[model samples]
Target: MPHDENSTAGRVATQERIETLEADTEIPAPDLDTRPPSSGATRQANDDLRSLEAGLDRLQTDPEHAPRAWQRFTTSVLPPILFVLALIAAWQLYVVIAQPRPDIVPGPLDVLAAMSQAWESGRLQTAVLTSLERGVVGFLIAVVVGTPLGLLLAEVKPLRRAVGPIISGLQVLPSVAWVPAAILWFGLTDATVYFVVLMGATPSIVNGLIAGVEQVPPQLRRVGTVLGAGRTRLATLVVLPAALPGYVAGLKQGWAFSWRSLMAAEIIAVGGTIGFGLGSMLQQSRELADIGGVLAAVLVILFIGILIELVFFAPLERRMLRRRGLLGGTR
Candidate 1:
């Protein structure tokens, strides 16, 4: 009886103490009428703030770093690659399906086989190297001759007025048109081919240079004058650099003309002395009645042209135009 009484009395005293503490703090007890929601509300707000911070971190970091390189490569480089593959595949398909006389359309496999055979026999490399050497040498000569001529045309108004139309017209003239005359002039020698190539290229290069000069801002010329640039110094430093892009364009056009002219001359005036260029190879294939060889030669011509354009002009043009801000960075 004494133990039970003491226990009951202690429980009453503990309850009274809890009631008194709750009253002093002005907070309801958990088991009583109600409890304050402040702690739960704070926890919820903290959770929301943490979630928002996490989201912002994700937004700022991930998109800029890893995928950009891949995106650029795919967007900039892949299309050309895919186009080339498609073109080759289409050519192969056409060759397979047409089943034309070998003289008319050679299969891709046949062309490749001939290429391989030519390589093994050492003739392909010899022919390619010979053609490349000729093209490069002829192109350099054209640049040397044409560039000065172009500058003259650009600076001298009377000369420009006299020859500007002719220069532009020369670009459209077929290189084949010069073959007969070139042969007549120089006969079967390489000099004849070189001469024709120079004739073919020179006009285009000159025109390009003239155009480039014309494009240079008049203010720049005024600036040069104020800086005490002499005629020669102005031409060399201010005008030439300003007109370089047009001059480069002329070179590209000139190369095309030179290549075509050489080919035409080689085909019409065949000789061992001419060596084996794409044109000579093509002529030989035609004479031999070998379609596969003809196709192979054609492919070689196209590939070489594209290679030279890409290697020399494309990048150079891009750089120049970009520097000038004329290209708008499309390349």
Candidate 2:
């Protein structure tokens, strides 16, 4: 009876102590719940944070550890120049050491002298300008025709199926093959020259553009369609941009064809003021057995092509690759 009474007292004492402790402890009132920011506000905050990070990154990298411009010049620019100089030096050494007949291979000095003479005589400038004018006109015509033709062939399955092989075959066909037919049809006129140039260049350009457009990611096309772009708009904005590298390649080839065609016309169709160019000079030099003059003319031809590639096409190609991220980040 006493043990049971003691157990009941202990239970009563424990309950009273718990109640007293609860009364002494103050319960915290809940804070009013705040509404979350709207999606627009959240997006803005994230954008701000990204901008902050970008700025910080830029500042951190303001002082570059490596000289990028110098490195690019050394690796990309200097090597080609050095290689070409070395080649020229080697050629000069061979000429001096061998003392080969000038008719077979003229020395560098002899070629330079011939170039200097031609420059003073104004023949070099005249021939260069004449050839360049023809090339420019021919290449422009090729571009005007080729771009749309390529797009059409790429877009229309039936057209591509019908004309694809012909275009490819035309590219493999030498520009010189057309010269005889062009001469027969147009008879030594600028028309003949233009016909040959167009025949040679248009096919290469069209093929390049077709390849580029066809290679455009299908995902991009679908995306463009989903974004409400019409076929024409999609081609102009999406497909063309994606196919820029190939398009550039086409333009480069078109220029080359135009040059080759012009040279052929100049060589074969001499006498008219219209037919006067470096090819004419070369022909004349060869006929007269002026080995130095022949070499000088050849050098001028090579130099012009190289100069055009460097000045116009090289920069354009580099920009396209860089924009596409092909040449930007570390490899």
Candidate 3:
């Protein structure tokens, strides 16, 4: 009886202790209706945070923050113009100093006169148009052929191992070296020029794409795979976008190679159904011993190259870099 009474008292004491602890630790429910308003400093801090967010958003989207049109012209266009002007001035100064023979090295003014005469006769326009047409067509063809070939080579290890070195070798080979073989294969025709252009440009494009693929981070590929992207999707959506810089560089190089090859083939092949191009004009001037005409033709070629780079490749690369946040500033 005594043991039972002691056990009951112990249980009662423990229960009372638990109830007291619970009462002491109890938290009252917050009454939303009676809650005090936020302090002035808290409201001010929130406003400041919102203002900061708005400022960041404006910085991202505001056109006023970008480089102005005049600024862009000054930074990009003015420098090249100044450089060309300085070069022309230097050439003129050298001519005045040395007074070289007109047949050997015509002055810039003589070359300009030749260009003006050709322009008046419409020969310059025709030659430039013809050459440009050939170069564009050949470059387009190379892009069509090389893109898939490069993708395949980049994806396939065995194929790349077998053919990669050969492509590199071809890139190093002079475009002029292909002229004789192309002429023999296709005759003195537009086909001969196109064939040489293809030979010169295709390797550069292929190698470029391969190089780009190699530069793609392995982690990116893994991420694509994790996202359940198929092989084609992974390449086109993920790899290609990431590899754009190298691919664009390759395209620039390919165009240069195609232009050089077209010139070589046009110069060497000469006759048949081939239209008179800048190369043909240059050759004709050489044959006639017209140094001014030769220099004018060369100048036209140089101008065309610079124009294409400025109009096409430069903007493309700049846009790509800007999109990737690689460029230093907005333009």
Candidate 4:
């Protein structure tokens, strides 16, 4: 009977310990495991990438594909204006810091006033027009003469072998160096200026066209040959079109040479119907020690250079590059 009572006591103790443990700790509820994002979410991401690629392709291929209207305000108009304002601010700061004598280096305001005076008097317009006309005429002459010469060289192996190096060599020789010979040959007339411009520009244009022709793909030549094109027709229609970029680049450089050559001739060959160009005007300002006038003339020269490059050549270059898909469209 005592053994039975001891066993009952042990059983009661075990039961009490089990109840205490169960009350102290809680059991966790069964739950499902986390799964990844759905297939619809993945499909949405793929569609977005495809849309982006399509937009980029359109930008490359479509000329009329305009950027959003807001981009015009943000990119086309505001940035250049802001940059010009910044440039002016920097000029003002420089003037404040340097404090040079007016005759030595006139401030921006002085140059502006001098330009205003010339503009009001109409001398600036006449002088600028004179320079522009000469430069444009000279450049056109170079293009007319140089393009044919370049093509001849490109088409004829024997002639190119004989004269190609000579043509390139002339490019290194300064146009000013030719001015002395030109004056001796033609005297100080307009002929001398035109001669200098031609000498300066022709070699550059020739070399540029030659380079473009050289870069024309052999595949393109083969294609033209397969189409039963003769040498002249192939070059004119196929190879020349392919070489437009290098040729255009050459034209740009040739124009630079023409402008510089014209300026140099104007400055050095002064008097006797040489005409009053900005270069001559600058020289006169220097002679009189009128720093503002000198600076104003320089500003006008810079403006014209920038204007032509921006308005004419830059657009042409961009259009060519865009058509080739070598450059993306404007943002």
Supply candidate 2's per-residue lDDT for 169. Answer: 93
Better of 3 and 4 by TM-score: 3
* Top candidate when judged by lDDT against the true structure: 3
Least lDDT summed over 10 consecutive residues: which range in candidate 2?
16-25
How well does candidate 2 score on lDDT at residue 242?
88
Compose the digit string of candidate 4's lDDT tens values, residues 1-331. Answer: 4545665775555554443334224543334235433589876998898899999999888456756768857976688879988988888788889887777767789999999988998878888988898899999999999999999998788999999999999999899998889889888788888999999999999999999999999999999999999978998899999989989999999999999888888888888778777778878878888889988998888889878988899889977888897776665
> Model 3 clash pairs?
none
Two-way lDDT contest, 2 vs 4, winner: 4
**Candidate 3's residue-wise lDDT over 147-172, tens digit each?**
89999999999999998899899999
User: By TM-score, how accurate is candidate 4?
Assistant: 0.77
Cα error of candidate 4 at position 201, Å: 1.0
RMSD to the true structure for each prediction, in A, is 22.4, 13.0, 9.5, 21.1
TM-scores, in order shown? Answer: 0.74, 0.80, 0.80, 0.77
User: Candidate 2, residues 8-40: lDDT per residue as tens digits?
Assistant: 775554554443324224553344246444489
For model 3 the local lDDT of residue 268 reads: 81
Q: Which has the higher lDDT value, candidate number 1 or candidate number 2?
A: 2
Off by over 4 Å in 2: 1-67, 328-331
**TM match of model 3 to true structure:** 0.80
Candidate models: Cα lDDT each: 0.80, 0.84, 0.88, 0.86
RMSD of 4: 21.1
